[model samples]
Target chain A: MHETAIAKAILDRITDRLNNLHHASNATAVEVRVGEFRNVDPESLSFAFDSLKKEYPTCIACALNLELIETRALCKDGRHEYKASADNAYRCPNCGSAIGTLVSGKELDITKIVVSQNK
Target chain B: MHGPTELHILERLLEDNEQLASHNQEHFDELGLLAVNLMSAPGAGKTSLIKSTAKLMPADCPIAVIEGDMVGELDVERLREDNIPAYQISTGRACHLDAQMVAQLLHTTKLPDCKILFLENVGNLVCPAEFPLGEHLRIVLLSITEGDDKPIKYPVIFHNCDAVIFTKSDLLPFCKFSLEKAKDAISSLNPAVEFFVVSTISGDGLPQWRNWIVEKANKKISHLHIGL
Candidate 1:
């Protein structure tokens, strides 16, 4: 349910922000970033967004885009630097120690919004 | 209207959920609740521990549980049967539970009276550790049957946990489980994490576990009252 909760939360916030902006007649597009480590299913999120859109007709034309970020692991083995591969299982290549910390992938954010209003 | 589209970047899509999670944490702090998010592989005895803990808690101390699963409400049903207030959050196709889901469940359940809340996250080692549910404590359970290399294999989970509960301890004698090695591996990853060896079936080491939880809960509650 990671994507379900995340998608709902994103859409709910978008609606709130749009409503607060007093753009009752305008549609908007929102982009969100989800890290590869977050293990979110983008397709499921799209499905959820479609369902939510039905309730908020004003957001019928709004577009939701997901940007997936991939992260890797970094560790040191006896003064030697090493990085793990892109695979799910992360471990030190040299020492085989799985204590390597995440270098990038675990991030989820709503970066920007595009609102379409009549001029 | 025919038009060429412009591309825009909207980051922090989960900001709203994060805000709600922050609010939930504030509420938890106010009540002095030590919310523990328990994550593990399937059949790791998370629910069993919940039952034992609930039974051991003092009558005045209120405890509640939120069970996350893919489909059935079996955990919820079992908890309710034991006279505990439990809620089920179905993720459908989702693999793990996040802070927003916990926040929504907290809002819908209206369980302000509880001093301690247990979120039994969906049985998964990888994804659950990635999302912060604003829990004061994160306990990862490992059974003797799961093999001793779990910590070395799943260091991320151990690194994020505040404590580790080695359940099904009674099977240790029969299985090739090495408690010492397991502790060493977990310690190598998270030296500060406390450990509790318990068996729900044998009722071993449960009282000490209960006491530890109660003491922490009481301390948190006192701190909250002082802040007020």
Candidate 2:
């Protein structure tokens, strides 16, 4: 539902960056890392990105690259690391102890944009 | 022909919103206020919870509100009728209240003197969870009418909030809302979250909710004092 806004934000930021480049005319792809802990739906985000890209002539050929990160948990006792799931109550799988720390899985960032000036 | 180049943007997607949120956080800290972001799906009794809270809070306590909706100033007007200091943010088309809109509100609205600020976000279990609007605590409401599978389906929102309030408790007997099932789903997602079962109509469990807010506010103030 909010993917359109996200797409706009991404394109706007890249567009701003594009303005500063010497001869960059368009982008081929934009890469983003999304985490399992985030509520974003990558499919919806991609669709929104595709739909909104038409407004920016510089991003007409742009494609969205979504890399999803899995949610992981570290045990408080420093003995275990496992995929975090609601089934385990986010606890360490080996010891059944408390969650020590969240390792990754909460990322929502754009890593790189593939841009070019070539026809 | 120039080769395609990779611009390593490596930036947070919501950087602009986050920066403004930080500014709002600093502003709140300077004013010795605790901002709570209250969220829920449509018809979750968020407004009724506020009205009940107003009745339960001590008369001496200073509280203000920022109401967000897709469009309309109706809620702000309703709050003003009760003499509460309030501001309204009509999102127009936005589904959630982002930090930039709140920053805009901060710039335009002169909130009255208050120790606690309740930001009633636009009704959504999904989008609002993605944006952190400079709040000390995030509370999400779930009415009994909504069903028990919400936490399991929307784990991101369920797992992120500090607490969850089960509203419309008075109608529990008439509905199929299984509290145990709901709790099971919630505990599986977030074991440490505080839970409150409330009914604004009967005033079954509002004191605890009201007290929780006060305790959080006081704790925030003490933290600032310690920082000084």
Which ranges of candidate 1 are over 4 A from the true structure? Answer: A1-105, A108-119, B1-10, B221-228
Over A1-116, each residue of candidate 1 has an lDDT whose tens digit, in order, gives 45666667776766666676543444567777876555567898788877777777657777888777764555533333444332423445666655345565666777766666
**Docking category of candidate 1:** acceptable
For model 1, residues B1-228, the per-residue Cα lDDT tens digits are: 323233344445555545665677786787667787899999899999999888888987879888999889999999999999998999777777777778777677677578789989999877687666777778899999999988766666786677899999999999999999888777655556789999999999899988887877777632211100
* C-alpha lDDT (0 to 100) for residue B219 of candidate 1: 79
For model 1 chain A, the run of ten residues with the poorest summed lDDT: A79-88
RMSD of each: 5.8, 3.3
Q: Which digits, one per residue and each the tens of the lDDT, describe model 2 over residues B1-228?
A: 888888887877877777777788888887788888899999998878887798777866688999999989888888888888888898988899988889888888777878789999999999998887888788989999999878877877877777899999999999999999888677655667789999998998899988988888877732211000
Per-chain TM-score of candidate 1, chain B: 0.88
Candidate 2 lDDT over A1-119, as tens digits, reads 88878899899988988899888578889999988877788889999999999999999999899999998867667647788777776666787765556687888889999998855
Stretches of model 2 off by over 4 angstroms after superposition: A75-79, A86-100, B221-228
